[model samples]
Target: MAHPISFLKGVCCGAGLMYFMDPERGRRRRSLLRDQCVHYCHKATRAAEVVRRDAQNRLQGTVAEFRHAFQHDEPADDVLTARVRAKIGRYVSHPSAIDVDASGGRITMFGSVLARELDGLLAAVRSVRGVGEVQSALRVHDDAGATPDLQGGVERRGERYDLMQEYWSPTSRSVLGAAGLGLMATCLGRRTPSSMLLGTLGLMLTSRAMTNLDTFKLLGLGGRRRGINVQTGLVINAPIEKVFELLSDPQNYSRLSDSIESVEDLGDGRYHKTVRLPGGAEAMLSERIVSVQPNELVRWRSEPDSFVPYAGAAWFNKLDDNRTEVQVCMSYNPPGGVFSHLAASAAHMNPKMLMDEVLMRTKQHLEGSQPSREEGGERTGAAASTGGHPAGSEPQGSPRVEGASSPAQAGEPVIHNL
Candidate 1:
């Protein structure tokens, strides 16, 4: 097979040589090919030059525009200060709380401001005409009694009043109870197995209505009354003290968790956190450190007026000289009642998965390794049943908590004591 194939290749090569080496036509054909190559090469070079020139022109235009927008000739200190103040007044809320000082075209802003508002305020002041530089000495809300107006106007107040009234009204509860009784009556008339089940459900609904509980809350089908719990644990190859230091600082949360966009220190153990939601939306939450037990435990609770009320605790247990086990527990009430509960369940937005991801990232960051997927099944099995076991005896598994983002493996830890 090899010999025949080689002979065929040699014959083909000879035939091509005979055709191309035709004395008169071969030379002209070769010359035409060379000329065409040279022509295309020159054309390509000219095209390249044109593209280069166009790119240079575009870069110059961009630089000029940037300079025109950002760079300005210095003006008198008083004039620059006035310009900056005007800018701030136009953009920032509670302008009266801010004090402006100017020296050699540099503007300094001092006062109490909301953490979310500070970045935009500073950027606006710096962009003002005639201002050379801007500095902020702004204290946050907790430091200076500058809490933002989370509640709005008279109409909003009225709506809140109405909602509270509805929640507490005996008449509303009576109506729900009547409907449940009617259903029970229908079930009694039918007297079948399905009818009996329906009657039982109706009786339960009636009991809930009598007790002033919502249907979803009574049935435990949604997180309307009770908050969802999530718990996760991980072992990090870092000292407990070092891990605690990083976890204690609110500012470090944004770096540790992908869901947290930013953490603003509001002073006095309080922080304002901006979190990114599943669908590119964002939410602002206020949290305060409620307890700190050095390298052992840190606990935080959401502010009273937050959109979603939540509490979280991180427990640090030293495993060895350079290894530590971190256990996190979070309980939260999803906003918007049953609808929000359904949404959260559908989106798989549970705290357990979020905490697991956070721990994984923290471990990678401390150990100087690239982040990888969460490994192993949750370790909550025997440890959760032990009822607050010693730190050293806590199992290295995740807890089987309600509202888990993912299905748990068999023997998953269940935490009813969070």
Candidate 2:
């Protein structure tokens, strides 16, 4: 029952060290992380601006309402009539067909409205401020089939809520996320059964509000639609064939990535991996390579019952220079649902951070890693027989990947990142 919370914070400093202290690509990763932080800060600033504006407007509106409540003066006839029309517009199919006449403190409506909407329209018109009495001379219709006023008219949409909609605006999401966090913190601290239930509710609210994912995805219930996503691309200073060889073969992961303790190749493109968890613990995983193309692409998915189910793919494109661009995409089920996923992200144990480390190691291994044959003039007969070639030198007849037909571009969307 070791929870992700227990192992979370201890790994952040260590993860940062490995993430930024690597000999190769360390500077680049640090730069990218800094840019992300700056971008996020800008977004936060914009959101704060919007929130401030909204608060100011709400305050002004509240003040206006209070001031208007004290002094009662009937609006002009045209103004009151316009208000009545506005109030009842959404409840009926044809507001223009309704003629509103307002004089003194009384209002009258004369038009043909749908019979179903007549009651609502009268009610809405009656609710308008500065109106004393309503005089109805409206003709009602069951349908808009032959009525000239209701022809080709449709009812406007009524009041709808942001939370009730399929997609919420960014502002709504932020507000919900903030409220959910507060509720979770307040409820979970009581240490009671009821408090625990409330805390779980708060956690779901926070997760769904922030990620905008279905509950099923966050709970890791659906096939391939289970939550969490990691996607990024980088160019390594190695040829396409060399980079593909290192990435496509699972055996090299242990040496190339700090997160991997070992990868035991089971032949036939299957492997079992021992992964180092946050607090120095380990988790076992079994994955079978689902597809592969020689020096071009590699795709794999975790076997059922694996510690954390995941699927990933990597694409290789040979640049004009000797470098290769590697675009990787991965989705994985969180070990303990979305709560644990968020915890791991806070602890730098998320897939994005791990992939950054792994790709950095790959860059280091492929770039200038081979030993020189003329080091201190200590050359063996085997080195001479190999024509002074480096140990990691290219093999014969490796195709030069120079077109866009094989791999997607860096900015192109790969798999569904959600």
Candidate 3:
């Protein structure tokens, strides 16, 4: 009687009974639950299968890596040198600075190598089979120390291809994703503490595996190197000057989208913005106006100390007299990680999607042919140009996203070229 969990269980049972016994929609709800269970069971069975039989492009490297176990014969000298060089480049930042040579199955590496990298390079070279001996004819420097050869070089173009390092390979994804799905399927709807904990962990792991992002990046804990970009644009039924003026100021953001609560101008080209987050929460960010070119473009970024960091830019293109293409590009470390994005996307809460929505509203507002924008241009068919939307009605036009890198330039780490 005194146990809180017991009380919670009783309450949950009562609620479930009430829910399933409802006269109106209980049957539908029960049927939906049954269908979901069957679906999840099938998924769990597949997850438990470990790896698929067919080789996949993403899994090619992992498959090849395992082949070394069966490889007993030594490769030719040139092939061995290529293998060592390929393997060693990923372990060091400056690979080109190091020279690789192999003769009679022996490797001789000679170049200006970093002192810290020497051990790793040597070990990696020794890992290759058919190597008789290794000779180091290299000048090792403790630090870059103005060393030309050891300075300003990165690992050869293989690290990005190798998902086994900092990134997850297809094999890792298959195993981990299956485990997560299987766990969640088993724990679904269980109210016990351990069950809930496991369910949460399963969800996190599944999201991580599905997104190929580490936990730090998912939580926005500063792993946002070369951030995700959303670039999309659409033509608005308004003059270039009118559209440009509206977007030139941050205050107009709220006018274009209902999701924006408010944007307060705080003088000196800065603003305080309040936006609705996923799940009906709100966040405030301090923003800096990086640059502005009238009737051309505007760029902005969140302050470093702000709780949420983001950068964006909008470009105005004149298309004849009464229409303009508004190209918007937003790049940011997605806050709350990949799962949050998946959820938000399901709910239509994606930021890029919002851009389209707001512009539609802005287009509607402009289509009304506000008196200010119509300086004696006389009567034109407003509804005809904008499609027939009743006056004061909401806009329903869809905005198109570029899906390419953003064009607006932002500060380091976040600013990627278009």
Lowest lDDT block of 10, candidate 1:
381-390
| Prediction-by-prediction clash tally | 6, 0, 4
lDDT of 2 by residue, 169-277 (tens): 5556667778888878978678788877877787788777766666666676664524566677789987787787766655454343345555666667676666667
Using TM-score as the measure, name the better of candidate 2 and candidate 3. 3
- Residue 97 Cα positional deviation in candidate 3, in Å, after optimal superposition: 1.1
Ranking by lDDT: 2, 3, 1
Candidate achieving higher lDDT, 2 or 3: 2
Per-model TM values vs. the true structure: 0.39, 0.50, 0.60
Off by over 4 Å in 3: 1-74, 153-166, 189-197, 220-231, 235-254, 264-269, 276-282, 289-299, 313-347, 359-418
All candidates' lDDT scores? 0.59, 0.64, 0.62
Q: How far is candidate 1 from the true structure (C-alpha RMSD, Å)?
A: 33.6
RMSD of each: 33.6, 13.6, 11.0
Q: For model 1, how does the per-residue alpha-carbon lDDT over 1-418 read when each residue is reduced to its tens digit?
A: 7699899999999986876677978886577558768976996576456546655776798798788776567778888777777776655566777899999878888877766667778778877777777888987663234255422212111113311532434433445567789889989899999988889878875765544434443334443324545577889999888787766655554344445555666678776665666666666667778899999998877776555666778899999989999988765656543345445544545455456655666676777675343555332211111011011111224221111122221111121211
Clashing pairs in 3: 218-337, 231-402, 232-401, 232-402
Residue-pair clashes, model 3: 4
- TM-score (C-alpha, index-matched) for candidate 2: 0.50
